[model samples]
Target: MSKRIWKYAFSSALVLITLSGCIEEKNLRPFILPELVNTPNYLVESFPGDSVLLIAAEGGILTRYADDRQYAFTVSNYPVLDQIDPTDVEVLYSGANETFWLRSDSLIITFSRERISNYRDTTAFYRPTRFYFDYCLSDDGVLHRIDYYNEIWDPQSGSFLSDYFLAIHRFEPSGSGLWESVETELSVRSDLLSSPNAVFKGDELLILTNPSYHVSSFRSGEVVAEEIPRESTFDQVVDPVWNTDDVIYGLPSEPAFFSPFDAIIELPLVAENSQRLRLESACSPSADVIGPVKVLKWTDQEAVVYVQYFTNQLTTANEVVGYIYTYGLKDGSCDINSVQSDPILLPFSNAIRDVALLNTELYIGTESGLLVYDFATLTMVPYLKNLFDEETR
Candidate 1:
């Protein structure tokens, strides 16, 4: 080839490559990477037919279903708070007054309505190494927060403090400032395990310690622990639901509920007792099975229970598949009508942490984002990611 032709071809190639690079950069600039963090705790407050979904993880993301728009805000956005870590903020309650209560290691922050900018540090608690908190609203319009300290190991002191104490804090509106606080401590060493699930049933709090359950009276401070009956060999009791007359416990074979007088009443899932729901392997098997009950919601005639089943195959390295089962209860009998057998694969190592139901849709919460499944269309959509895309566009 001639020297002039070769030189012209070389210059044209360089220009084309540069233009392609510029186009690629411009296309990537609009995409915002999600902040990977722990799976968030989800709170759904329903009214009439709509609901307000709150995702508290790497900051707070609020979605109002009525409008189908979401607001993603971070605690660090408040410069006065000194760039508080968003993962440290745990949502406590979403009130009817359009306010939310959140807690960190050291402070309890309250956000007014849907405005993240309008917030205040309402109160403070002991900055423990690890903690879990749950709250219940009373009939008299008082909010009660139960603070459970799981671990209090101080590295500098080399001491394990906060052994087994639970705190109950009551909050009520007072004039124009923060809510009034009344703190009470309950010695719960005998009733709680190292890791226990705390649930509020009316004025009483129920603590489920895997195979056993405990009930604590807020009025009398009386604690009662009940063991599983010897006849029933259920693997675990989890995802307790509070009903008007009973407190239901999620079991493997049958659904059991404790009466007001502490009597155990179990409802059969199937007509034949031989075909019971078994969560464990009968013998030494090739694969390991793990079933964890996540949530339970009840109506007047039926109840819906959500459980996640995980299978870890020993043949492959890190090969795990997850299945989500939704069982419907009618006439004291249970049957599975919905199953999501996705392989538990999530972006940024996230897992399906929790699930909730609103109207005809199922809301699934993960470590990174939220997804919604419509029963009528049998389709699932990424709710949180779509909101981010819309905002950026």
Candidate 2:
């Protein structure tokens, strides 16, 4: 009741609280946290069996290991001027024993996993035109870029001053880790090819001219265009997948329309008996499919397709989902109604950016984090966990 007695009791409670805090700090364990700069837009196997690399949309790069922890690039590791921004990378491509970043303002930066700090700038030699639309690294270590130029009509002049063109520029890796400009070929006029997608197979360049369903093949300084005969009346075919020149598979759709994944068609490129096969009837009837379809794995006898579908429409909120299906094929003769297997629907609803298969696991790069689907276990696991919270951890 006295002041001296109250003061003594308060001092004793303060000492007990300090001792408990010390004990709590000593018993705490280290928590694993994500070091990602931003959403992982692209995923690649940076090192064989050791780590996977995640690239953000704005040039942030993180290396994720099997234990779920990540390693991010420090300021001293990459040049400040050429440093990858964690908020703004456009394209991250890994091929031909190196990785490339198509940065802002037509800057092409390439680095290897072995020597990441020793990066080389490829755009210094090519310089800038109006802009670049797409790029790829060919089999022979040559970089191919689709360059575009806009033609502006001068009101004061009688004629158009600047002409428009879409061309492919080639760059080879010269000695001392430098890229040298080699050749440039005119693909087509700016308005000639609609939704043109270019890819390389060995020494030949294949450009898909959509709506027409024609593939323009360029080789040895010569160009040849051939049509993929259609089985049904369709407006356009997108996402062409083919390993060999003998056959190609694509989804037929009406251009500029957000529709369901109705059917996928196969076109043979043989000299004789070349025809298209529509496999609409083989798909599952109950699958509520939407969004664009992508063929992930393709072989002579089978193809693995990923379809984005809509779900949870009956509820207050709507969600988009994904389904994976396998389609079988016959060598000599094939039937359109007997190829599809049952679909495997994914559990999560995040928008997928990219997907890659390694051994029995499927690595899916989503807008939020990385996910892995194991075929052997038939289970999906979130590879990267969310940022650490002190209270939860």
Candidate 3:
């Protein structure tokens, strides 16, 4: 045989061997079933009928999670500051709209549908000795900002200067004109906490401090500051939700540890009314389940509470367990029923920050990521991982 012919035959044999190996490798590869993945550590807060979900995450990242059709966008630019910290950042969304406000260290950045604008005033009116402010959006589309100040002490004079007062600014939008700023009378006080919890009920702004709740009317400039009624030591209110017409729901700040017994207080907005209701009596689950109340929501028919609990059975150390307690309120009565989740599907930590319900699915926010609990399957799934996995692939 000729040398050229022999060489050709050898090359053809090598090619066939390579093709056979490729075929075998393809057949041997196992199929991977798609599983849930962790999303950005976002505190999920959504609005009704709104396609975009705004989240306040770590590293000063403002995440905009749109509908499944669009990709997520993040905004972290703070032009005035050298480094933006997420711990100092507070995000608020315009209800049922794509607009959102990001307040971080004395700067307020507004993210509209088309543009982003930043606001900060170092002048006498809006100036802050400390870099912090708390704000809320009213139902009439007015932005209420509360600037906090601490009392300055003079060691030379041996007296404290009364500089503690809340400067309330109402940013009202005109007839498609620029937002008009109307300043109200400075509610004089000495014990104003930094970044107090504020919410909007209809047109009134409800501000909750340590021992008092300040109810202000933006239209008439009427400010009412009243002490919080002390029924129990556990009445220290935290995370107040303006769920209904006249009631504000909040979890007690006491008993910080995990307990099967948890209480949710329904506080009235009326100044003359000190009557409060404890919602814990309505929630009765098995003794093995125990957790703290993370979030509360009230609908026309039911009041839903999200609790992070664990079972006594053997499970993975990183497993997350929780329950969705839904109370059917009939004539101001609560009939509670809970849906327990499987242990394997829960987040690793019990740091669930927020919760919202859309249709029949329940969405939860935790330190790890966003989780979705399906009412039909009685299962919990990681949201962000499943959302962006296909994009990465």
Candidate 1 stretches greater than 4 Å from native: 1-50, 57-60, 65-70, 79-95, 116-134, 139-142, 146-167, 172-241, 248-289, 296-305, 309-322, 328-332, 337-355, 365-369, 384-393
157-212: candidate 3 lDDT, tens digit per residue: 54553444555667653454333444433443444334455677665566655334
- Model number with the top TM-score: 3
Estimate the TM-score for candidate 3: 0.59
The count of backbone overlaps in candidate 2 is 5
Task: Name the weakest run of 10 consecutive residues (lDDT summed) in model 2.
Answer: 334-343
Deviation from native of the Cα of residue 152 in model 1, angstroms = 22
Candidate 3 — what's its lDDT? 0.53
Please provide, for model 1 over 283-303, each residue's C-alpha lDDT reduced to its tens digit, 9 standing for 90 to 100: 111233234343344443444
- Flag regions of model 2 displaced more than 4 Å: 1-34, 37-59, 63-95, 98-107, 114-134, 147-166, 172-192, 210-242, 249-280, 310-321, 329-355, 366-368, 384-393
Q: Rank the candidates by TM-score, best first.
A: 3, 2, 1
Candidates in order, TM-scores: namely 0.48, 0.53, 0.59
Predictions in order: lDDT: 0.44, 0.46, 0.53
Q: Model 2: per-residue lDDT, tens digit, 238-289?
A: 4444556456565654312134455555555442222344334454433455
Question: Which has the better lDDT: candidate 1, or candidate 3?
Answer: 3
